[model samples]
Target: MQLSWSQPCSSGMIQLLLVSNLLLWECVVSRPMCLDIGYKKLFLQELFDRATVIAQYTSNLTMQMSEEFDENFAKNLEYKARNSSTCHTASLTTLEINEQIQQTQSDELLKVMISISRVWYHPLEHLVCEVAARKGTCETMLSKIKELEEKNQELLEEMKGILVRVHPGAEENAYPAWMGLAEVRSDNEDTHHFALSNLLHCLRSDTDKIVTYLEVLKCQVIHNNNC
Candidate 1:
């Protein structure tokens, strides 16, 4: 008697798969180059840095204004809230006790009760007015902030255009710091390349980490608003 065994796949099938995979790998390895840093990366880096700095400064200013407004609003609301609660309690107690009184001057007692009633309800009317005004003002502020954000985006695009025009690769020789500004002021295309490269370097330099700081600030503002 003889015994036979069955396998998942034949050796021939395994060899064919290995050959196909090797061919695919070779094709992928022989592909063309993808990215060239050249001067483009430098220019973008510079633009990003400058934009970051401006963003941070604007965010800081807005935050300070918001904090001051919030503090004052909280103080005003707290005082008003406490006063209304106290007045409401006192008025209720007076009305209940007055009902139980055995004897008192009829006309005088009625006048006093009417006065107390008015005082108790006066704070509520004022509170309603205050709430309405606050809602209107908040709506206006939101509109203004939206406008500011749009303008900021436009300005950043303008900065990016300036950066692209000044790419160092576009120019062979570099100019001194003074010439960079002079060229930009004169609107000369020749010196623009030099100006851009210098600008990019300045933005990414250790001494000018404004972009990093601004990114942090923007994130904080977004988080605070969400909360």
Candidate 2:
């Protein structure tokens, strides 16, 4: 009579096989996709560079605005001093009002710059850690990108508000640096708002590209594993 093969009868052998399978699964899961990791690092670097440029540009703008206000205020004070005999009190009050307006405008510009810094720093920090550790999934990165885009949009709105205050019913020619030919027809646009809008558009475009790449990478990995 021929002998037939039989399944393992010992619980110990069954348990050992289960443990081996678990270890194998862990190995597969833990192995980082090197190519994807490299892509993420490059993407983050590009994002950081763009953010730095924007921050520096805004900081310079703030300085220029502050200096311009100071120059104008000093000139007005000199004029008032020369004409002090005519209406000293009236001139002083006018100077005070001008000073207050300048102070408010300067403060608004500083706030916008600060907001941009915050929006840039936090997400980049988190992304750096996630990319380094290879701990987060593509879905997590997508969530972060979306959150960043939303915050960036808010920043654009804040900049628009500041521009509106600084240049109420401002003609397109009044702040040509910020207003487009098409936007010039509207009396309510300025350079700061235009700059912010362009920045937000670029950020959203970059994020969209990252999201698409991530989706493709994830799908390819899944497909490869299935094969």
Candidate 3:
């Protein structure tokens, strides 16, 4: 079957295919198609494993970004505090501005971290469990996959905006860079965007293949039943 990104497999179609495959497998012990049952189970298990790995990788990357942001923000704060003039009034004003910057940076990092957990990590982890236990219908699993894909896309857009602001450029830095301190490199931002986009593409491809495979199985079952 041809997989078209333009035309995703509908939830109803997935449910129909899965139900057909299940019903056919139940009576296939004495039939020539018995081996297909084992193959289907193996294929699904493998897909689940791949998804689990991708989810774990994304989660780790997000956590790493969060920690790095926190450390850099702290260092920037210290640098500002130390460099401000010793005059009491000047120091007070500097402190207030530094505090506001810290708060803003903290809020942005927290937003990104929370979005990553809510959109990608939590749902995929739950999906791994469901697939392993064979507890949910294929349609349900596909729906979750679709949701993840959407969330991943949303995250990519958000990261791009953050990268544009934080990336070292000619303009005033959205994230203040400490002169002697190690800066958050532009490469790190690129890596994060590339990783997420790659994962999202892979997931969409895998989901399409699974749906196509199920469609093929359903057809074979119908043909055998007709015979």
Across residues 109-150, which tens digit of lDDT does each residue of candidate 3 receive? 323332333333333444334333432235544455445545
Model 2, 124-225: lDDT tens digits are 333334323332224543344344434444434443443344345532211112212242133443332232233333333333322333223223232331
Off by over 4 Å in 3: 1-31, 74-227
What TM-score would you give candidate 2 relative to the actual structure?
0.26
Q: Which lDDT value does model 3 have at 85? A: 23
For all predicted structures, in order, the TM-scores are 0.24, 0.26, 0.24
Task: Point out where model 2 deviates above 4 Å.
Answer: 1-9, 30-49, 65-74, 78-227
Off by over 4 Å in 1: 1-36, 76-227
Once model 2 is optimally superposed onto the true structure by TM-score, how far is the C-alpha of residue 96 displaced, in angstroms? 23
lDDT of 3: 0.38
Preferred candidate (lDDT higher): 2 or 3: 3
Task: Candidate 3: give the clashing pairs.
Answer: none
